[model samples]
Target: MTDTAVAAPTVREVVAALDARYPRSWAEQWDRVGPVLGDFDLPVETVLCVVDCVPETVEEAVAAGAGLIVAHHPLLLKGVSSVAPDTYKGRIVHRLIKADVALYVAHTNADVASPGVSDALAARLDLVMLRPLVPAAAGSPAEGEGRGAGRVGELAAPMRLADLATFAAGRLPATAAGVRAAGDPDRLIRTLAVCGGAGDSFLRDATAVGADAYLCADLRHHPASEHLAAGGPALLDVAHWASERPWLDEVAGWLRAQFGVTALVSDLDTDPWTVHAVSSNKENHL
Candidate 1:
């Protein structure tokens, strides 16, 4: 008699498990979640996790031999009028389909989950006893009735703002841009608030919580200026993509341990802008 071993969970099954854990419906109304492509029946040999679904990240997924890519940000958030190759996002969509690579996003749902994006970020910075910063509004799941967003925590030892920034840049993926801060470099900080991406909206929460500093991404000029002027917490702005990249590793590790399937973390720097700055020495040399 020929023996035919039963197959384990396919890509679709794994995706379904993820969806059950973090329901797509729980995501913010504008978010684009769920599978982007590929057949559910196809066996998933390997998976890749990333922060963004940009062309570079897709390329990395292809190179990693990933059958599926689980990303933090949605590849298609808004309704697309067309899929012509002219547009950047369009081209990315085209490339993924051509490569037979599947995409799944867990945006705000993952953000609000316990031990989620914000929690991971806080852990990276060695923060302790983390709790919700904004403490999601009453009746919202994000209030930690089951989930929450934006974690606030205390540092094991308070450090100056500049020192904390240096620590963060070292712990996170090294980027040409490194880290940037807007506050008194010498200000000692203990209580800190962190949000994974585009966290300007939580400034008030951070201030109200009495956090000595707030770590997040996509801090606009006017808001940051106004917050500081209002005696708000010191702000440390990082690449939106970079700040959330650490969670990819955490997620990949979890999936690998949970399902026993090989998982890879995409190391693509999907941030659109590249840093180009001249040092004083370089200027003198020039």
Candidate 2:
């Protein structure tokens, strides 16, 4: 009997495909996206998908013998003086290089891709008629593909503001900061807007798009309160990590189906908040 070898995609090929799907040009001018570190010619057999490329996730990839890691967030978005391997980020870089693992980031580019971050989030809530909350500007790769920063859509059925918050809480990955909402709980919701991470910037866009309720993460005090005061849509805030984790599955599935690779999502929770305590005073405190 003759033996047949299964061919694997090279690091260059995988990064190319990712860039094609979520072009770097579509990302914000100040943002970093695309391949970060790796041997371009190395054959990639197994891939690990994660929301963040921290030390823990790097260890997970090394332990799994993953040739490549696709992360939603950048490992070194801010400028660093060096990769001395003693510092946290530096250690991650050295670890991956030693393990022969490559790291790629998809930040804002993935957020604006057609089946982007918020699309996965909306899928959890069973939203329909999905469209860009903030459509891309002219000449970008994602410009005319119904691709943009955040997403807006209609729910399968109308529900009260309270019910929608509860439903969203049940749908997203569990985090210490489970979920919180602001506005009249009894208000009805049919249209919804969602952004996967740190999406407070899109509050006005959600309102302009006529979303009855908006779901996202990292909602600060003044903007949230001012938006509500101005009669904006209802707001639902989830954990930053929880909001973006769903996209890992999407990318993992795509990698498997598209290239016949072994793609796995890391189960580690990267959200900073671990313990959430409820205030004893409840409504009386306010």
Candidate 3:
């Protein structure tokens, strides 16, 4: 008796699975999703999932012999006339091609997937009864029970606003910007809203839903202050990378189950902020 060999899937086959899971039509009009570069016919044995398609992740994928890199953020989001090696994004693109590593990006489309980025983040916090913070359009391709922009849910039990922030800091991946919260520290939080990436865009939506607190990344100072001043839910801002990194593991497990391939997550911290120091004005700890 002999055991059957595990089969590696071609780039096209894997791309089809990714697109089906996170439909390209769900992506924002200005966003890019799907395969960025790769030989569709080439077989991919290992896939590296990352939050960003930067030099560090590309290097990690190459060193690990990853045939394909599934990136949450697009390497080339804006228009560019040249991909000369001297340019930043160009260098990364060049490295991937040289090392025979194909690249795919699932940005906003992945965000809106039924069990997408925010779902992972919400899970990290042990939230329950999750629903979309911003539901998809009624007739859009993304329209469905689980398809939406962000997530709203209730913690297993209530905690103080400050404790909730600390709990989140501990739950999410470590980063220079761990977690920052703005609101009444002693306030009890139950219902919470979360968006994996930048979420200032949904502050009003969170408030509308009567969520006690909202957690996400990249909460700009102005928007955050105004939201709180307007009596919106408390805010917790984590590192942009830390917030979305959870989805990498979620998707990695998914790929393994769906395609039976070696899908790994890159732990490289690509959040840009390497050092963090708190104010000496008071004894502050997170």
Candidate 4:
């Protein structure tokens, strides 16, 4: 008997390819990465990529005719006490099975990959060559290998804090709310530090590295105020979903190039919260 090339890579092969590129061990200890369901022997035709796996994204995958969904955030985090159809996460699981869609998450492993989440964010603003914000700990799974999180880079041309904020807003996906800045808007900024998700924890590191400004999401009132008061890097807060969404295309592109399989991006806005619409009274009908 002789072995023949598989018609299409099985789910197991796809998983193996991803693991080789971004080892599961590289994921933060608390993160859940890898296949959540579906058998390894199953054949995968089309894969959809998204920043988060929410109901909307699930629907998008189905509508896009995808058999697999590769998301940056894990849908099943923490031990699931129960997966009954009544629960929210349970419903998501049910939808996947009903739609015959497989779910795989990359989480922190993708975050730490070179040219990953933060790198995509930095590219959006056209930031030049730079270094990592919190260099991956030495001896760690992806460490000493030039893979890390966030980034600190120089701008193409020096611009004021306000101008940078405006520039970022224009480049990134638009949301009901635009970008917001902290510190003197007119303050000149040439060097920038950026992380995709919540990044308050890296304030000291950004400061120590002498970044002129830092861009990320989920900056609390106190932390943003205190960082500026302490003369830390100027801050720019954006929608967490928006900040990380740019990487989905990169991920899908890589999967397509490496695996030669169809890859799609889920356009569904998966962020849980929706901005409220406030209407002016002048529009009231007669």
Candidate 5:
């Protein structure tokens, strides 16, 4: 039997479908998410999913003929007076506008969505029987066990902290930052927790949840050091971009399934720190 070609949805329709899953209302008050730039009426024949909507990813989207870019991070989180072509963010805006590609972001709302960012990360790590690391408020719209900032769960079997770190690095997309860990590497760990991006803010929550180890990104020195000194969970820090990139595939698949658009995930390395130089004699310095 021959199959019929599915028509792609309009940009408005695609944005609506995405908002249905990761509602704008669920986002924090300070967050600037949802559709940023584009003509809603334009038919979206292709979508590009990316962790960050930087120049490289923007070029990739244009090259791939994507009419819409679905990004995890907001391109303009703070209010801006203008989008002049001279500035960086302005250049991105001008580029997307010139290319007729719409831009949409799904920041914190996507984080707290069930089967969302952290959930996707957990799945990649093979975490089982997951629950929210920080549960949403009691009457929040997101109902169920795993709706929150991050996810906490168990490994299929206990392994040394070092082994778990290796497992995570293997599963995650490789980046210049690579993975760094705190706490005793040899410590046995089974219960695990994960937050897909910049999760240092959740260190207390991870400890409170009794996670033996927490896998996250962009953990700063003071917070990590104090947390470990206070007997908190082991920390496995990854690249912010790498930590969130896994969701691109899942989100792209959803876009394809829901709207029949040809969705592609951009594998371009957009993480700001692209190089690392280590000292001799194995004395490391970031």
Candidate 6:
């Protein structure tokens, strides 16, 4: 008896599948995404999906025998003079190249995808009747009924900011920083706005759309303060890692179904802020 091996999808075919779901044209002009490394003709039998393509995740991919790493963040955001093994990103590039593992990114393109980042977050928060906070341009790649940068939606019933924050902490992936809020704990919230990653940029849009609160990650102090000063929507901040982690499973499932690839979501916590220490002395010096 002869054993027959299953055929593997090439790097080009896997990337095509990803581009079909999150078209590269949907990415913002400033953003860099898509295939960053690897030969297009390389056969890919195993795929690893992750929010960030860090060294640990790279090692995890290598250990898992994954031929491709579908990362949410682009490894090279800016032009690099070299891919020398000494530099961090360079090291990553060299490692992937050495392992013959392909690296592909789907950043803002995935953000505006139909069942995109904000959509996944909204689902986690049990949001209903969702709509895009910033609607994609008509006839654009991401143009759809509920496709855009952020999402605005409603809960089953209005709740206090504290309650909502608690719900978010429980619902989101556990992380060191956990979930933090920057508004009245008792403030009533009904309509919610959410962007999976850093979302301070959308404060005005959330306010203009009449959202009661905005849930996102990487909220800066100045922006959060200014938004609250302007009486904009209340803020709920979470770990950047937790916010985008939800979409990994969805992407993996889609890849598995579409191309019969063995796709896995890396559960490693790649968020930079590891230990968050709270000061016992509450007196403000400033």
| Model 1, runs deviating above 4 Å | 1-8, 85-87, 143-146, 278-286
Which regions of candidate 6 are displaced past 4 Å?
1-6, 284-286
Q: Select the stronger candidate by lDDT from 1 and 6.
A: 6
Q: Candidate 6: what lDDT?
A: 0.93
The TM-score, computed over Cα atoms with residue i paired to residue i, of candidate 6 is 0.95
Write model 4 residue lDDT over 186-284, tens digit each, in one string: 999999999998888888888999999999988899878888899898999888888888898888899888877889986666665568476777866
Residue 143 of candidate 2: its Cα lDDT? 84
Residue 60 of model 3, lDDT score:
92
What would the TM-scores of all predictions be? 0.90, 0.96, 0.96, 0.92, 0.95, 0.95
- Which ten-residue region of model 5 has the weakest summed lDDT? 138-147
Better of 3 and 4 by TM-score: 3
**Number of backbone-clashing residue pairs for each candidate, in the order shown:** 0, 0, 0, 0, 0, 0
RMSD of each: 3.3, 1.5, 2.7, 4.6, 2.3, 1.8
In model 1, which range of ten residues has the least summed lDDT?
A: 277-286
- State the lDDT at 234 in candidate 6: 91
Better of 1 and 2 by lDDT: 2
lDDT (Cα, 0-100) at 75 in candidate 4: 89
What lDDT would each prediction earn against the true structure? 0.84, 0.93, 0.93, 0.86, 0.92, 0.93
Query: For residues 1-286, could you state the per-residue lDDT of candidate 2 as single tens digits?
Result: 7777769999999999998898898888888889999999999999999999998998899889899999999888999999997898989999999999999999999998889899999899999999999998887667887988889999999999999889998999998899999999999999999999999999999899988989999999999999999999999999999999999999999999989999999979999999999877656643
Shift of residue 81 alpha carbon in model 2, Å? 1.1
- Of models 2 and 6, which has the larger TM-score? 2
Over the stretch 120-217, how does candidate 6's per-residue lDDT look in tens digits?
89999999999998999898877876788899999988999999999999999999999999889999999999999998899999999999999999
